[model samples]
Target: MRLAVVASHVIQYQDPFYRRLAAHPDIELTVLFCSAEGAKTYHDVGMGTTLRWDLELLQGYDHRFLRNFGWGEGFFRLVNPGLVPTLVRGNFDAVLFMTGWAWLSAWIGFAACRVARIPIFLYGDSSYVPDEKSVRAKLRAAVMRALFGMTSAFMISGKLNGDYYKHYRADPRRFFPLPWAIDNERFVEGSAFAPGERDAMRERYGIAHDELAVIYSGKLIERKDPMTLLRALARMTHPAIAVFLGDGALRADLERYASHGLPASEPPSFPVSQEAGRPGGSAKSRAAFVGFVNQTDLPKHYAMGDAFVLPSHFDPRATVVNEAMACGLPIVITDRCGPSADIVRHGENGYVFAPGDDAALATHLDALARDAEMRARMAQRSREIIATWSYAEGVDGVAAALKSIAGGEQT
Candidate 1:
C-alpha cells in the first residue's frame, strides 16, 4: 500500500511515528509537509523561546516539503498551492490528512484525493470535550460531518478522540485506534541512568535524594497552569522539589511566585532568563526552573524524578505523559488532559486532579512524595501502561486500516 501523509509541518512527536510507518513492509509512506518554517530555529510563540529541535525530524523518512506561500506561523496561516496537484499526481493508494481543519492545504489535498478516487484516512487528535454552545462550534461540527462522509476511514488517537469522530457521525467500524505515541525505545534508553549518573543529575539539578522531585515539563504558559503546580507544592508540608522544565510568557510571574510566596497584590517583575536558573522561595517550597530541555535530554530529567505532573487546564493530548510513562515515572495530570483517561489509571498509576484545583493537586503530590513504595508500584504500572501505546502499535493500526479498506471491509 502506498500512502501519502499531508501535515502542516514536521512535528517532533509525529515524525518518529511517520518514520515507522514508512518502514512497514506492506506500506510505502511519503510525508508531505506544508511548511519548513520549523526546519531551522524559529521563535515559538507558545514556548516563548527561539528554539530548534535537537533531534532529526526528517531523517529516515520518505518526505518532501511543499512550496509555502503563506505568511506567519501555525496551520491556519499555511498556504500551499502545490498541495492539490501533488496529491493528484502522487498516485497513492491512500492519503492521510493529518491536519484537515487547521490547514487550507490539507483540505485541498483531501479534495484532490476524493476527486482522484483515492482512499482518504482522516487522522486528528481532537476530543469530544463539552464547551459553550456556540454557532462556530456547530458549523465546525457540520463541516467535520461532511469531511467524515468523504473519508474512507478514521485514525483516532485515543478513546476521547474516537468519541469525537463518532460525535461527528463517523462510522464506528471504520475508526481505528492509532494512539498518540512517542519514541518509546529512545525514551526508555535515555531513562536508564547509572547509579552515579543519577546522583550526578540530582546534584546538578539541586535535587536531594531525601526530597521527592515532582517534575513538570512543557511550556510554562497560563494554559498549562504552572502556577497551580507551584501553589500546590507550596501548600504541601512534605519535603518535595517542584521542577518546571519549559519556558513561556508566564515564566516571570512563575519566578515571582517561586521567589516570594504567592503575591498578595500583583506579581513582581523578573527577567525571563532569571527563572532559567534556580528560582527563589523557602528551601522546602523552592522550585527549580530549568528552561527548555531538548528531546534528547528530556528523559534524564524524567528519570531523576519520582513522578511527572502536567497540570494543563486544557490539552488535546499531552505527549509528555506518554514520555514520562515510558521513563517508568507515574503521572499526575489534570482531568482536562485527553490522555488522562487512557494513561492515568487513577490511584493505580497516578492520580487525576480536577483542573485548576491546587489543593487537590497538593494532596496527590503529598501522597506520592511521602510514600516511596507507592511511587515505585505506580511507576511500574506506568511503564506497563505505556508499553501498550507505542510507535509499533500506530504502525500496525495504520497498516491494518489500509488493509481493511483495500479489502472493501471499511464500513
Candidate 2:
C-alpha cells in the first residue's frame, strides 16, 4: 500500500507516529508538509519560546515540503497549491488528511482527490462537545458536517472524537479506531530513570522525598489554565509540589502564585484558607517552575512526578496526557480534555474534574498525595491504559482505512 499523509508541519508528537506508519512492511508512506514550521527554531505563541524540537523528525520517514503561500497556521494562511500536482504525480493509493477543513490546503486536496476518485481518510482531534454555542459555532458545525460526509473514512482519535463524527451524522462503519496516542516505547524505556537521577531532579526542584510532586506538562497559556493547578495545590493540607514542565505567557503569574497564594483581593477560587477542618494557608505547597522541557528530556521529567495533572479550559486532545501515561504516571485532568473521556477512567487510572473546579481538582490531588499505595496502583494502571494507545494502534487504523478503500493495492 502507498499512502500519502498531508499535514501542516513537523509536529514533535506526530513525527513518531508517522515514522511508525512508514516502517510497516506492507505500506509505503510519504508525508507532504505544507511548511517546515517545527523543523527549524521558531516562536511558539502558546509556550512563549523560540526553539526547535531536539529530535530528528524527518528520518525514518519519506516526506517532502510543499511551497507555502502564507506565513503561519491560520485557516487561509496555510494555503499550499502545490499539493494538487504533487498528489497527481505521487500515484498514492490514498490520501490521509491529518486535518479537517481548517486549512485551505485541505479543501484543495479534497478537490484534487475527488477529481482523481481517490479515497481520502480524515483524521483530527476535534471532539463532539465544543467550547461555545453561538451563531458562528452553528455555522462551523454545519460546515464540518458536510466535510465529514464527504470524507471516505474517519480515523477516530478518541471516544469524543468518534462522537464528533457521529454528531455530524457520519456513517458508523466508516469509523476506524485509532486512539490519540504517543510513542509509548520511547517514554516507557526512556522514563526508567536511575534512582539517583530521579532524586537529583527532585533535589533541583527542592522537592523533598516526603513531598508529592503533581506534575503539569504543557504550555502555561490561559486556555490550558495552568493556574487552576496552582490554586488546587495551594488548597492541599499536606506537603505537595506543583512541577510545571513547560513555559508560556502565564509563567510570571504562576511563579507569583508559587511565591504567594491566590491574591487576597482576587476573591479565593478555592476555599483552601477558610476551610472547616483543613489547615488554612496561602499557597503552603511549593512549586518548581522548570522552563520548557524538550521532547527527549520529557520522559525524565515525567518520571519524577508522583501524579500528572492537566487543568485545561479545553483541549481537543491533550497529547501530554498520553505521554504522562506512557511514563507510568497517574492522570488528573479536566473533563474538557478529549483524552479524559477515553483514556482517563475516573478513580481508576486517575481522576477527572470539570475545568476550573479547583475544589474537585484539589480533592483529587489530595487523595493521590495522601496514599502511596493508591498512587502506585493508579500509576501501574496508567501504563496498562497507554499500552493499548500507541503508535502501533495509529498505524493499524491507517492500514485498516487503506484496505477498506477501493483501489488501495494492499500487498
Candidate 3:
C-alpha cells in the first residue's frame, strides 16, 4: 500500500516512528512536512531558547518538505500551498494526517484528498477535555466535529485521545490503535549502564548516592507546572533531590525556589507564589536545573534518576513519560496526562495524583524514595508495560487499518 503522511515538521520524538513505518515491507510510506522548522536551529517559545535537535531527523525515511507561505507560528505559521500538487503527484492510496484541522495546510490537504477520492486517516494525541462555555469553544468544537466527519479512520493515540473521537460521535469501528510511542529499544540501550557508569552520571548531576533523584524532563513552562514538583520536593522530609532536564520561562523562578526553601505556612496556589518564599536556605541543594538536553543524551539523565515525575496541569500525552518508562524508572504523574489512563497503572508501575496536588505528589515521592523494594518492583513493571507500547505495534496497527479500509470494512 502507498501511504502519504502530512505533518507539521520533523520532530526528534517522531522521526523513529516514521522510519519504522517506512521500513515496512508491505507499505510504501512518504512523509510530507509542512515546514522545515526542527530540521535546523530555531527559537522555541516554550523552552525560551534557540535550539536544534542533535539527532538527524530526515535519515532513513522517504520525506519531503513543503514550501510554507504563512507567517507567525503553530497553526498560523504552517500555510503550505504546495501540498496540493505534491499529494496529486504522489497518488497515494490513502493520506494520513498527523494533526487535526487547525491549520491551513491540513484543510488544503484534506480538500485535495477529498476531491481525489482518497481515504483520509486522522492521527493525533488530542484528548477529550471539558471546554469552557464560550463562543470560541463552541466554534472550535463545531469545526472539529465537521473534520471528524471527513475522516475515514482515526489512528487512536491512547484511551483519552480515542475518547476525543467518541465525543465527536465517530464510529467505534473506525478507530485503530496507533499508540504514541518512542524508539523503546534505543532508549533501553542508551539507558543501560554499569554500576560505575551510573555513579559517574549521578556525580555529574550532583545527585548523591543516598538521595532519591526525581527526574522531570520537559519545558519548564506553566502548563507543565514544575512548581508543583518543587513544592512537593521542598516539603518532603525524605532525603530527595530533583533533576530538571529542560529549560523554559519559569527557570529563574524555579532556581530561586530551589536554592531557598519555601515557608511551610504559604498558601497553596496554582503557581505557588515566588514572592512568598523566604531566604531560608535548604539543608542542601533541593534541585538542579539542567537545561534543554538533546535526544541522544536523554537516556543517561533517565538512568541516574530513581523516579520520573510529570506534574503537568494539562498534557494530552507526554511522550517523555513513555521514555522514562522505557528507561525503567517508576512514574509519578498527574491525571491530566493522557498516558496516566493506560500506560501508568497506579500502585503497579507508578502512582497518579490529581493535578496541582503537591501534598499527594509529596506522599507518593516519599513512599518511592523510602522503599527500595517498592521502587524496584515498580521499575520492573514500568519496563514491562512500555515494552508492549512500541513502534512495531504502531506499524502493525497502521497496516491493519489500511487493509481494513481497502476491504471496505472500516468506514
TM-score of 2: 0.91
Candidate 1 residue 228 Cα shift, in angstroms, is 0.7
lDDT of 1 by residue, 34-92 (tens): 88856789888888889898997788878899898877555558788798888888878
Superposition error at 259 for model 2 (Å): 1.2
Residue 42 of model 2, lDDT score? 91
On the 0 to 100 scale, the lDDT of residue 1 in model 1 is: 86
- Candidate 3's C-alpha runs over 4 A off are 262-283, 407-411
Model 1, runs deviating above 4 Å: 73-75, 130-132, 262-285, 407-411
What local lDDT score does residue 45 receive in model 3, on the 0 to 100 scale? 88
Q: Give TM per candidate.
A: 0.92, 0.91, 0.92
What is candidate 2's lDDT per residue for 247-315, written digit by digit as tens? 998887877676666322222233322211112444333677778889889898999989999999889
Over 1-411, each residue of candidate 3 has an lDDT whose tens digit, in order, gives 899999988787788899889999988999999988899999888988899888867888899888889787657777988888888777788899995676889999998887777789998888955674899988877877887887888898899988888988787788888999998998999998876998777666666667789999999999999999999987787877788999999999998887665433222222222222223432346577788888888998997899999999999979999999999999999999999988999999999999999999999999998999999999999999999998888898899889877854433
Regions of candidate 2 where Cα sits further than 4 Å from its true position: 131-136, 262-285, 408-411
Native-structure RMSD, model 1:
4.2
Model 3 gets an lDDT of: 0.85
